[model samples]
Target: MSRISHLFSGTALAICLPATAALADLTAEEVWADWQSYMSSAGYAVTASEVVGSGSVAVSDMTLTMEMDDASGGGAFEVVLETINFVEQGDGTVAIELPASTTMNMSFQPETGENVTVAVDFDQTAPNMVAAGDPGDLTYTYAAEAARMALQGVTIDGITVGPQIAKLDVTMTDLAQVVKTTVGTLRSVSQDMTIASVDYDLAFNDPESDDSFQMKGAMQGLKLDGTGKLPIASDVQNLNAMLNDGFQAAVTFTTTGGNYDLSFSSETDGSGTANATSTGAAFDVSIGPDGLLYDVSQTGVDMNMLLTELPLPLSFSAAEIGTRFLMPLQKSTEEQDFGIAVTLNEFSMSDVIWSLFDPTSQLPRDPATLVVDLSGKAKVLFDFLDPAQAAVLDQADTVPGELNAVTINKIELDAVGARLTGSGDFVFDNTDLATFDGVPRPEGAVDLTMVGANGLIDKLVGMSLLPEDQAMGARMMMGLFAVPGEGEDTLNSKIEVNDQGHVLANGQRIR
Candidate 1:
């Protein structure tokens, strides 16, 4: 119902905290006040019926509502809790007791569409939660033997939808979390959480058509940590304003392993079934004074698909997959830093897939890999998240930023019995953008090395995969740019873009 609950449940954050053995005397009223203050600071409208009793405060019909808006439109969420109890635990701590079950309603009204509302039921079994520490600096610890969230129902503009329309259920086992909040000019919150396992199943059916979809998945050993410094007076929905006012947050989530199965049916696409599994996965994101950063990775991933149109099932696997990017969010007069990196390690396709083209198996079934790393400096000319600026950029031909420099830190590709590696650094001259056809003229050089290129080409010709004429043309192109290396079957090339805007391969000028 609260941000705390949301954080500990789906979006997790938890960290170890010091022992909270009774120190200073605490009251239930103080704990309630802190809870309300924390929620209010997070931009939630809080309301409830409070009754005071001996050493406890009973809150009934408590509700927390949040509304979010962006350039297009917005939606709202309402959490209604039947009852909660803040009981003083004699030992300077407060026992926060929640009902066994609750309901959260999410409503959406788009720019053009009927209004819709979806309700989710939340439940916890044998839950234990408590809060302690000073008024402004509080620590909350929570644990539950098991927890579950299931879709209760859906409605269109207050009219209930049929029960068969949609269904979703998720169960979590062995949940534990620790959260610490310090309120001042900035509402600083940090937390850590761990979950032994999570299982989910979802299905959706369109009454108007044969379109339907179903998915089921399970994940194990999830651990996450997060921290945020939110501006006290800024609206949580206004990310641009918050960033300008010194707001920042970061979160890292990881899972030991997971698997999923999905099936879909449609009049146009017919029917299909698919399944995927992974040994582990990780996701990390951060936003701060500098900019935004995002990274995701997975290891030991395999997927199989069967479709009505396909004669045989298609399957593929990868030893590792990952991508990362960092960029500036706010406009700046001077250049800002940015970077992007990608990796696909040991990727392989099933023989059933390869046999479609190379029935004789002329080429090796070795796994392929691709790695790239690019970093650059650019000037953000306008606010990326500002609605007005966004509208202007959409209508204008001018870009929102200007690239100044790029560094190709690394590049590697190994596949089809060939390997290639390269690196480069370039500086763009914005003043001379005309020479490269509106692209800024660059002054830099790139060094590339290739191994087994000729051998792969010969194999392709023998397999009738590449026509003889086409193979000759490819070799001609490679000869124009590359020179024979010291090792047999190796080629090395140096491509450069001079300050005068001339393109050259080795010492030969091509343009």
Candidate 2:
């Protein structure tokens, strides 16, 4: 192939090659060597398995392996190893035709008794990278297992059991600087369990601590298929709990200049006879450069089955469920900065109700579907990093710098056939949220609005949960908050909820 100079211009940029008139006779090996050297010198720690055969102009086959150590200071405990299988073509650039595969195994021990080891296997492929001068297709299959989960001095697992596991496969087109790093299709198989020691508390005819009791299930056929250009600075971390101390992070993500759509689905099954499943559901996720511009519309699902006839003494049927969120997080730029808008199309809840009386889906109630349409936005205070930066946040509260200001843009909620709106600014004081010094406290206020105070008052009255006099008082209060007679409905009430979860609406404390 002729050595045509490549120029990368837009989001999916390519490696630009300088145009030259003098055509030197550079072989495939020479080109590969130059590319390898350039990457290695740029801190890639490049290494390849021994090339099996030798050729200059057109080497047909070879394998290249490389490991990228985590420069994030977490130690060799964090590293990415990749091996690619390629073939040299008639062109000067080699064809990275197959995905580069990698496997990772690491162990970590915190001051707490949590011990974790992760085993990961995945392959990434990009065809005609150097030759086509464009990022090629990439696909990966990966699996992970994590054990021994603990939180706040409470051990959630018995006998150091495994509680987190997953198997995943994904495919993307023009992945590497080619088609804007947006994901195409991703499918995953997962199993997770959480068995609390409380189940063994002697108060319930429980077995000894040494006796083994477990709960485990598998989520199969989980898939997410989507397309859009990946933003240059987007959070694309392939999230793995075992590998990163249970901290939340995205494993792989990209920014798409244009809008894109995606969907997800899965089912759950288990070790025992529950035989429960949640299925036949889907989602539409839209992506844009600004943020997640999504219109979420999905059904919440639940299925259950009884397992009492077996060896154990539990008679309640199992519970299976699913839920989805379709919302748009507006861009922070001035053009769209007022309030974040969101909508939840349909939310359904269904479960088998066990009756010492009966045991059949017929006896169980019909599946319930809840249609919710909500839109709202709240101002963000500061970055919410898990466990990290906890101390700094605590200090900010004590001194009252940025912590003292109310942070919000706007918020709207349309759920369960009801609509409500709220906007408020709150300070991170000693008890509202975590303080800058690591102290935990709860303090915040939310100003809310709702349509038809009189209609709302009547509903509350019919519910009979509140006294008639109180309901009347509430009606009067609603009148005070009522918006002008015509335009849009409104309610001007400040809901002050304190550290102990005590709620006070318009000075009347209600916990």
Candidate 3:
């Protein structure tokens, strides 16, 4: 019976041993230490006081700081957290709680040698973290909370400014990261955050005057999703190596496909008040390793100003407007590519505004439309963000890069009873700046077609809006460059600049 009992006991012990080996005992102190070391490896100076308990650890008086030195002058920033508690769970997980707020202080000086200081306050709820395997990989999930951020102090050029308050309601679904303790590398990170609303109040004193200004702004329903892979290592130093070493990240932000509003109003001590309001404004932006993509639109906008010195208030309104842009992320020695598109649809004016420019109302009351699309390539000499490189370019009195080529992919205008459409391509000669008075000389052609131009000009002349001599000169200039089109009041022209720096219309040299 004794032998049988020993055999059973040994068998049970073997089963338990395997299960225990699968989970290495992790303490709250160990995790906190690893976090501190990881941040230090990433070029931040960190300090903290720790107190250990049975299954938890509390860190107090934590501080992290970094500094930057550049042509725009040097700057430093520091963050201080009052107290943070890390509690270990039975399931091999840790919970981080920061019941107190955090403070960040930043000081910087511009090239003009003027100093500035900005202080901020931030707070968040506790987040749950689970360690994966023995490699220090952490997967964390934070509960949505109404976080508050405030700008406590701002000093610019030695002038002190008043405080600003902001409330941000944020929720994060996932915040996962792989942190290697041995090499101190944050290999990968992914997160999704939603901001329900952001309301702010700002006040500042004019540096050169005795007046003060106050503004209030608010934004609603913003969401951000991002994932990134970093090439960070313990030994990494420069940005070039960090970016070139298989680094890639993409982030996208939107408003949940719903209409949002952003509005602001400002008031001066003695200069009255100004207000601007926008409705149905939507924003979407995406960024990746290679490029950035953005789309912004607003359905309606209104602005009003009441000045103490002016007899009447100024106001204006627009029906719809938007813009889109896509550009490369990194600068290269070779040609870099970029594109931009702008659109203004259904633009209308108030009666008060119209009376100022056209009291007789001779122009048509139709809403105007303006659209443009442009793409181009350019060669960069150095990194524009680098202060040293920018200083060199500034001292030489030259642009950081030279345009290689540009294409007017599309241009359309429908306004004032006239419509114009055009497409063009041009190549710039960087070596011929002197010929164009410090501007790059272009050698290419653009073809344009206009409809209703003649009738529009006739109306202007009949209404006494334009002098007869000026109208005749304009017609003669059009006759010299453009030929009559097949349709009524239509004209077509090709505008060009030759290699010899001569401007031409059609096949004839005009200059």
Candidate 4:
């Protein structure tokens, strides 16, 4: 309700608002009072007119406003609601009714960019929200049959853009949400949300040029789970101090299936159309006192594209794709853990795409795969969480961290008729950077195996894809670095960097 970041919690579609419950049978007045307290604690300036009745309280002309300023810039946001009813159910529960329509306005002034303002309109079909539990630990549950959001207006440096220039609409159906809040030294919130279906359509047109674009998409079985520790004492404008004060969060989002279609036209770039579909996808992110983590994955993806500049259509597919990264953000004297991984499985292109190069079908057509996993440790010289330090580091020539050690957990690649695999570990000597031309000198050994190399080269040569001289040069290089194995068309090699600053291949010194 207060900060811009809260807009991302769980069902981002749900306009974030603060409210609490009670231990005893809750009254309409108590519930309304707790709602004000929760809003103030979350750093929102809340004001409204209230009409008290026998068993209900009518709130009207309500406005919640928040402002944040930092090194980068400053921004202000306001939410206006026409009416909300708080009715005490006779059975120790409070039933909250939200207005059918809500208005949100945002104005931002960046230090280096033009001022911008955005206005959005939110509408829902009779959302049923209820609150129960004690004041210390309150729970709220909400459900709605349908909800919609429309972009009302946008202004950049006093230039207004109406719906004719840019338009957006997002709709959701069968929505359910639950939030649990605990009050203590800090406020802790846990959220779980699910939406049966979602549909979005957007369009943009340039008034100056004949450039235009439109996009439409739909998704099913959307879900989100998230937890966070909020600093109820002060506004979260200073993220570095907030993180230091025990602020942490984790959020995960998933969807069962989705599809999208996109079209663009411009005088400079020409016209194109793209469409894609996927069976499932997932995204996860977490940040705590120690470090940060990010992971994303998608499965069963298919895409098609048509461009006026190109004569043929392009299509591709992949069974699975994934990537992950984990690292520490705080300044540390001791080495901290960090890791990165990537995977692409069963990736292939349509025959029409392949025919562009290998029309004769001289090379074997097979799905390609690639996988890599790496872990390392580093000593951080500057804290990334601190904005001031980040600014200084950005202007410096050197990086903010020093690599201490690295391990290649796995590496595999399979394409066409060739395959390769390897693994290794290494430790760096940071004090002796001159030995490796200002880089930390590393000492390690890696064992590699390859199959079908010579046969693939021969096929390429036969298809005229590789010149005879180039094929001969490639064979010479492979022979110099590798030794023939017992199996046909197989090669094995051991690459090593010794403590004496010597690089070796197959136990023979190369440098």
Candidate 5:
């Protein structure tokens, strides 16, 4: 049996020291050899001074540098972290501290972007680095006035917001296994002549699996605030390259407990030929144990874009987007389960008619009040080798191919204040969609009912999706022939799709 003990001083961080005389059974050279062996096996290239300090163990400072290799290939690039003058506390922790007259240098390269180099110096005694206990305490500090960014041609809002210089002051405190960890703060100072005001702060903590994440700060207040119109050729080139030589907007979202909040905004103007601007937007939602609850609100968004020679000038403006919604997530292990809910909201859009239409009062004559309710669920996978989740494999990422056999239990959507509802359910065999090139395509049945036929038809006609004459004629036909199992005013329809992609309405295939 063996024992290891680490020292914890009250009001101070715990430090690693040589094991008590009980382990005195080993000599200094023997201990150093063991240390080197341990670090190498754990994937670190370790080096240290040979001179052993007084007493039995070889007590001396050491340096360690580690870098990842791409052989394991999960991501595109590898990670590299470097630390100089890392003193091994002999117990288990390591330290990198500097006296008043020390210099530091480090470089960082992202997955696919410009390289940033940072150099730091200290005019005072920096913080100490302690060992890693169940939770450990480690601190370091550096005076900035030496950081630089070399972004060849990056600009924002018509301003060349690159070729930057700045200084950073940082302090870090990490406590392992303990109840809490505190990372003090970071402060950055930039050159006085700098035109843009860009500020950023970020912090996070994940104590254990059972506990939730704690966020202390964020990456915010990064602004390119300048009133003068500036040359933005460099900015345009960089943006075009990043967007595959054009303009695009892509966003991803993740939610837990179906609750979230997000906000964004931007604006720009420059050169007589091109101009762009943006406004505030936000999304907020919460799903309580009671049921699903959500709220979304946004405002002031417009993109008046022009690419010469294009027939349709791209223009848009949004006054607001707001919604209140509720729904429940239900499930059962044995029986199939499903849930339903709806959202009540208003969304306003304005089409900019720069040439032929009035720019003022750009809002259309009719504002939209959108009401949508939806319900859906899936069946449990019964097969072990070929699961049901595989059936809809194309719809998701990280889905096991064996789970494709699972079938949809049911799905339904209600739109326009419940005036319309469409629903269907289906089962699928072990077949891949791509391979369906030869086999008969899967088949499914659908039922749709449109109530308030006359009013709905009028709304459709107003939107120009349906001509007034056609809408009136459809409503008149519904009046002449009553819907099966329903009244004359409602339009009831049945749809059947076969393996050959042929569709049928009311038992007649319309291929």
Candidate 6:
């Protein structure tokens, strides 16, 4: 006897074996029914026009619909699948396929105006889904060959605004998920997708003008990978509840290398061209109980552009650009902390572009850099994602929170022959906005040090980049606020805002 059979004995085997076998021997119809039930539980209305066969079932003209109501307007979305096929294998598995195209339509009804409709058409080549294992612990895999998609139509307030896409090709190699029936949850899911190429041409007539505008562009080699965990019970009906209860996800997108050439033309204003190339780019994002975090970085970015009616083209390049953001999760009316940083490294402009402003090339040709790091705390006034809360926020005149404190851990700028570095910590007095002309009053001092400013100004004056009168005015302003530093051609300054509404620079009252 098989080991599985050996685990059971005569009468006990007869009783429990059949039950276990029934759970393991899931049919195509059962799988489809379960999907329908699950979607319905998640607030979607699912329907199918025809369901044929038993073990190997084929469904036709299936649709899923969802509706959302908001203060600004209400919206409804419907997705239609032309056909789907499911074939049961003898090895306790079923193979599913979407053999035809899919279409989605969204309509929004504004509170005081007409409705708007947006439609999309998607194409695929029998993308497959394979399911296996027992009912309580099933696994499903999804994969697809290269496919195309395009925007079909768009209409707003009964006015047709045509939208189109010439071509978009996508391919997916790995996608999988595990479903746990006992807890009614998806244990985990992971996916990786690649966009092989994209070519597009779009045109729209100006509503107020007789002239029309058009744009054309192309790109290649974009990739995306993602993984997620849904700790909440999948059977939960409320979508917001699922997110609030337990949800964690992470996704990363990157470009393997690509070039894009975009051209824009207007019937009345001539035309322009822009070309860009990059070696690689990446963006990563995550969300969990700790809150949201994201990082974006790109390298080898080079661009050349000519604006309409411009005399010359502009060119620039950067070795790398990056930024990061973090916000702690706040589930209640409590204070939350956040951090942000930005970087611009090894950035430079072509001489042809720089000569327009600096004819003598007085500025240094070395690459420039700018970096900033900041962190702060604030009390969230409402649920940021809730439509009602958003409506309230939009109606308010100012942001609905008191900024407890802000710290500028680092601030650095390097360009031309000048370098500036500064750091500061500040506290805001939200109620004293009137003292700062409707802006939150800040009470603190920022210490700054600058190098090479005097030399840069002298060079600029010698190159005639700055008029003598303007240069004198600039020096006078600096003398009034900044004090001489220990180093040659260097200066130091302390900008302070006191509780008595006084603005001072280097111990001298300025305001």
Candidate ordering by TM-score (highest first):
1, 4, 6, 3, 2, 5
Best by TM-score: 1
Write model 2 residue lDDT over 219-311, tens digit each, in one string.
322333434332222222211111122211121211211111111122222223332233333344442322233332222233333343333
- Residue-level lDDT tens digits of model 6 in 1-511: 1111111111110111001123476677766665565455344577887556757878776666655444334455455556667778776677776654665454555455667666666565545566665544445555445445456777777777664322223332222222222224544545455556555555655656555555555555667676666543432323235557666678788876666666666667787888888788899998765668899987898999998788888899899889999876544566677789998989999898788888777679899999998988776555555445657778987566567678899999999999999999888887788998977888998899999988888988898879999999999998998999998989999999899879999999999
Candidate 4 worst ten-residue window by lDDT: 10-19
Candidate 6 CA-lDDT value? 0.66
Provide the lDDT at 365 for model 1. Answer: 83
Give the per-residue lDDT of model 1 (tens digit) for 380-480: 99896777788899899877788899999999999988999999999999899799998989999999999999999999999988999999999999999
Q: What is the C-alpha lDDT of each candidate?
A: 0.84, 0.33, 0.62, 0.82, 0.34, 0.66
Models 1 onward score TM values of 0.94, 0.40, 0.74, 0.91, 0.35, 0.76
Give all candidate RMSDs, comma-separated. 2.8, 14.6, 11.6, 2.9, 17.4, 9.5
Candidate 3 to truth, TM = 0.74
Which parts of model 4 are misplaced by more than 4 Å?
1-4, 8-23, 28-43, 51-57, 109-116, 156-159, 395-399
Q: Mind sharing the TM-score for model 2?
A: 0.40
* Model 5 lDDT tens row, 348-440: 333534333434432233433434434333344322112233344445554222211122223333333335556664433335444355342
- Specify the poorest-scoring 10-residue window by lDDT in model 6: 9-18
TM-score of 4: 0.91
**lDDT at position 55, candidate 3:** 88
Model 3, CA-based lDDT: 0.62
